[model samples]
Target: MLASLAMVGLSLMAFLSNSFGQERKIDQIYLDLDKKYRIPEQWTVLPFELEDPYKRIKNGPPLVNVVNKAKVEWISRWIANPKKVVPNAKMPDLGLNFEEIKAVIVYLSSIADKEVPQVAWDAFLLKKDDELSDDEYDKMDKIYNSGKGVWGRARCTICHPIKSVGGNVGVGPDLGEITTKINRNWLYDWLKNTKSHFPDTMMAQFRFSDSEIRDIVEFIMRDTQFMPEEADEEETTEAKPEQQEIQVLTEKEFSSIRKDNALAEKGRDIVEKARCFVCHDVKGIPELMPVVEKKRDNLAGFEKLLYEIRCLACHRIQEKGGTYAPNLTFVGNKIKMGWEQEFLQAPDIIRPLSQQMPKFNLIEEDAKVATEFMDKYLLNKELPQDVFKGEAPSPEIVSMGEKLFYDKGCNTCHAEGTKGGGVVGPNLATVGDRLQPAYILSHIKNPQQANPQALEPNFNLSEDELKAMVGFLVDHVKKKEEGK
Candidate 1:
């Protein structure tokens, strides 16, 4: 995760508050109630996911899917035959029954685009909790408890599940009653890159700003609410009107970062040349870093640090940006010395789920320029120790690596010899004689880069690991040309 503590404070208090609870059954108390209880509203439900309100679920008399034969058969059983087990939908029957209601309800609930309840929503809020102060009660009642934000903003209800309420989708673990389990900074990074902080975890990286992040932290552990009104009215009015902002300070600190404004403003024609926004936020930009983790860092230096860590917004090159690709921060730690040059000179496909990083068509010199900048200046740390060691596998080592190869289940798709896996790749029989170690290394680092449509997986391998694996493949097996 990018920043853990930031997310803790960023989560709004309402998300974690025990002030509300589900009191009555949805079916018994609200669903089966008389028409007088909720009938005044003529309803037109819309899916929350539709970006534009006008483009909601197609308003019509209602349509149903009939793709599967079993579904077609199941609906037929109760529609015409009229089974006793069918349920009722409360709408006056033009011939509708319980089974149709059951079928419709199940279908509607499964769709991501669905509407919030229009009636009895206020009554449901009263059921969230028994004890509550007047102040807390008033604030809680102002907005929809559904947890879906008005616009595109992140909502605690979107990520965290609260009892039977909220999106109730647990993409991340339930923070339901567990705030103390996380540290402040750790929470911030978790919101930044949950999978990185705890590899292969279920959290999605939410790019939020520092202030909103802080507000969430307070809501989760301390104040438990975001009442901008709670601040002193006079100071709130003035609101730290400082001329020297965080954005200015960060640009000065990390001046080497490549920017369109910095060069193009100087007649370098660099203004819109780089699609920097895709990866780098470049500060003072609200469209970037729209949401904060609400746990770690404050929203104070957002404009400044946007350029400082411009890599994380959407494209992760190393660990700086979004996790759309490899953590680009420590890329040097994983690759061999020559492999970087090849990868940059000719871009290759890497991750399977994503579009291949397009080749910038950098003539050798420019490729060298970017590669050197990344290696020497961009990453101001020691290169990965022993990452470039080219291990030449011997018969015994190849034999040993073979066990690890099969044990790790490498043969599912990649076959070796006369056993295991389907044959899809150039057989490794003569791989040792044809390909150079650097080429193999580059392919392993970013599979898509090697062959655009290659079915090869992006193992995200360290140079040392790729060397060992390649040595085993090249030396132990040999591929022959078709006619040779």
Candidate 2:
């Protein structure tokens, strides 16, 4: 019996050694590919471990993190057929031969633990009928699949994730593990009336019926294998501090909130008359077909120029326009007047990485008119006074902020001086001189409020942390001037 046990141990050791050798071979192939293609880190698909799946695990000697065979096959197909997998991926041809691709796929597949469920990719389509009776399960499945069209048409995948699929457009939180994070009833309520929970969210109201909403919730939760203990209905119903208090408003109070004034009415009329909805979706205006085919012929000067240049095609105002450019609704309150004028005239790239905004080549006269129009109409008049009244940061505070800046991974997205760490976000060296203190504070707290399409995530900083970050950003100009 002792001899047999010893032999079993030896066999296990040999198996592990062979596994390690195979993994090393795979790593060598990856290294070769990396050297040849100079592939971006985002493009690199790593082996997924069943336990602690989200965290990136370093490649172990015996390949601890197993890659599913299905995932490997999916990835192989994705690389070969980019148009099918990721239609919008602007990747250059990898120039890899079929043999090289196959080898890599085989290597990836070798790491997979066959015991694990094949639900990493295409998990969204999964309908675990075993959870319910046959008849009820069929009914739910039909109802759930019926809402798939709505999901695609709404571009829900653009901002959300369902296992390995979907783009992280960064407009909303990842919904991949949402079932584990949030309760079904709460999710249902949120789907029905998002504004009630998050008053300033950019998520548009989906006019789905009760049955459709239920179906969607079911579909989202179907593949959730591990539900957290914290995902209680009571906990989900509890509002965050930032969320507005739930209250029943009288007609007068509701009217007060709406605040229909002459200036706003005039602006609405002008926007409607100009047929801005053709290229824009202004917040308050009802959707209508253009009255005239040759609308540009009737308008002249700045109005005509605005439409001619197709400003609405890029820039958004009041959450109503294309998402490619920055929201200009509250730009007047955020940017200094002089800086805005200068930017309009010169049109230099504020964020070197972003190529969305091109040089307009506008003459001084037109630039000035545009600047004045933005300043006058798009201004936020009710900005809080406290943001601008803070004393210069103490040395200790500045030191803490400096440490926190790196600790918080702010450098990953924002460039400081010449160090371009990441290109996803804008440079911050000159931000202190450009943006208002109040706007900076508000933007840091909640970026989505300032720009619906903003990719800057809310870090949920404490008040002290918020102050420290704001001080660090605001003092950057002073530090630069002092040659610190």
Candidate 3:
């Protein structure tokens, strides 16, 4: 049955390729796909406006000339054997084959030849190398090398981007422009423990020696030109007097100081005003019972239940919710019914480096109801038959797709097998099994046709490239079936 379906799909693809003799533009493909699928207007979610805290820091410091040989070498090594640099790191496998690995290595080597822009204070150290005496140069080189090692070992690239290199996943803000916004003292305190500043921050604490921390700080602070001259002088002068005069408080002294505040009354006032327990659980808040009751009442129907659970809090259905998880607006069209059923029951870890959805442990009746609703209502039944019943792609086309996959840096954001890292995009390891060929082609051509809020960028691929990419993905499904 599966083989027959495959043959039909391949034949249709061949016909479509031949019919469209002239190369089709990406926009044309998008229009055609939208005409067929007709994205449901009801599923669309509009974005809400929020206050911006970093609005004042929009402009960054001027670019500085700095190059670190150690940093470049580390990038090259990571490109070659990323797993070795960060063991057990769940990243995309760029080296799916030798050719792909070679292509990536060549790209990294080219990047190394170019001078790295200074984003941190460590760049200053590199800039001073030419002016340093032989002994001083050697010492600086040692410090730079140690710092680069610390960065690689910590897998900082997984969450942060440094210039054109590193992952694009914005789990944390890009450290590439960090020096422009913060000072060394603040950076030091942050590195020591982020939670001390922001109680709800997601950053984890790392155990490093004080010297190791200093090395990392120096490397990060390399581009210190951003700091105002007056501010620098003020900080330097104030440091000594403050350090000498400051009295250290014992644990008992701190506890006594905190006890003087009438915290219970203040807490009650804040909770009453803001309804803090609506999203967060606060102990001993009897007033929150009514809110909990209201939520329970809202979960009476399927749609209301979905809203009550805050499905949009993580999954973007029609671009309305949080972007932390994969968009599910067209999930019915993407995933098979059986697979979706199983997935909802026992969610698997697809993106190991990023957040994973917890198992809902829903009752059988609720699961069945949700599954049925998705299967019947969410499907894009109007997709062309040719998409589902097309001719298999030639081996040559599949090879072209493979080359394009790495050349275009698709693996950087979208993980396949074990090569890519970060959850900036969905895992394409089983995409072939999940998505229809026509839907895949449409998505690659223009993702907004399906979901206006999708983060997947349109590469503006020509007719041949689109066909080849789709073919490559379809072939992935075939290989999985054969256990290749």
Candidate 4:
């Protein structure tokens, strides 16, 4: 689907040899049966396989439909230097010259499964922004603004970073300059059904209506942030030196050689030599790892939810999955089941500074399944049922806690009441509704003990100070009227 390359340049060949030469010398490592056949000590025999999204051998998106997904020109630029096209791109530069890149594009085109359906756009919307009539511009702007609102509600940046910012979830690609990469048609199809393009993708399948999808598409296409920034004229003139311009494969040029079998075979050979199959599912090359087919027909409850939603893509449980989100190994003992279920259905801003959970548009049944799974299995025995002994703390203790909270500068990171604070930690305005009193007390006592990665500091407060702080935080619950 993406462009191809043949030979590594001399410099790159030398670099790769130097970097991997030691491993190449050790053929014995592969031949040693003891090392090859030995079961990993960290691995455990399970009743059934739990799909780890992070552990996929083919890390890049499948190339079977890349020809339809990306433009030949964009693919050429990406193959040349991925980071130059998108700043956070993970694909390393293969150092392919122009001719090899063209052949690869031709090869990708030959393997395409189907044509990309063309999307109908308004005539005025296709016009350049500067060329648009005032009336047409206003109409386009209205749609763009509506799309912006939808983008905000969906919290696209929770996973996807835009311009090197707001990818706290750390799973999605940098979407900044995405406008230069894919066409509106591919984007529209992907948003409509991501699993169809990449079945193993971790992105949530949001239940967006057709109009919502269109609006989002408009915003993404029209937004300046998604487009690459133009270089300054003076800076370009004052640059140290002009490098040789790399030729990009045009659609016209690619179409000419697209059906050439000899060229495609040569491209395939180059791909095999470059080991492109290590990261991508190249059509002709044998996959380095066998694909594990998963059956979802009989899956029900949490197990089904995990695969469908790909929760482990962001979250970790019992040391498996990703660490981009909160560890759920002890979630049962940490959060109130009622709040957990409600949050799963309609997630709110718990952590304003960190990555907030995206609204998955879950049904009541989905929420029930998730909460039930956590409550039954995700527990920490050391955590008490209630640190307050089944009773609310006295008003005096809460008042004292409030003073201690501010005195210790807890508000520097956490927000409380009507006043906003630092966005470094979870907002404490409704902490009582979400967290169990016991977990809060325990966490505050030793932040590192609760979460080794937590930035929360240990104040080493006296027992009374600890109790007072917990009392104050617990009092931050929503009022009865506000709960509605």
Task: Evaluate all candidate structures by whole-model CA lDDT and list the values in order.
Answer: 0.38, 0.54, 0.53, 0.82
| Cα lDDT of model 2 by residue, 62-142, tens digit | 111112212433344444554434434333334344444444334333333443322222232344566566776667678
Task: Rank the candidate models, highest lDDT first.
Answer: 4, 2, 3, 1
All candidates: CA RMSD in angstroms?
A: 32.3, 31.3, 23.8, 14.7
List residue ranges in candidate 2 displaced over 4 A: 1-291, 294-302, 390-397, 418-420, 478-484
What TM-scores do the predictions have? 0.26, 0.38, 0.39, 0.84
TM-score of 1: 0.26
Model 1 agreement with the true structure over 109-222: per-residue lDDT tens digits: 232132221222234334333454676555544433312221113434433444324433323233433332333344444444443333222233344445444434434533
* Residue runs of model 3 more than 4 Å from their true location after superposition: 1-301, 304-309, 318-320, 362-367, 379-397, 418-424, 448-456, 478-484
Candidate 3 lDDT for residue 463? 84
Best model number under TM-score: 4
The candidates, ranked best first by TM-score, are 4, 3, 2, 1
The residue-level lDDT of candidate 2 at 423 comes to: 64
Candidate 4 yields a Cα-based lDDT of 0.82
Give the lDDT of residue 202 in candidate 3. Answer: 32
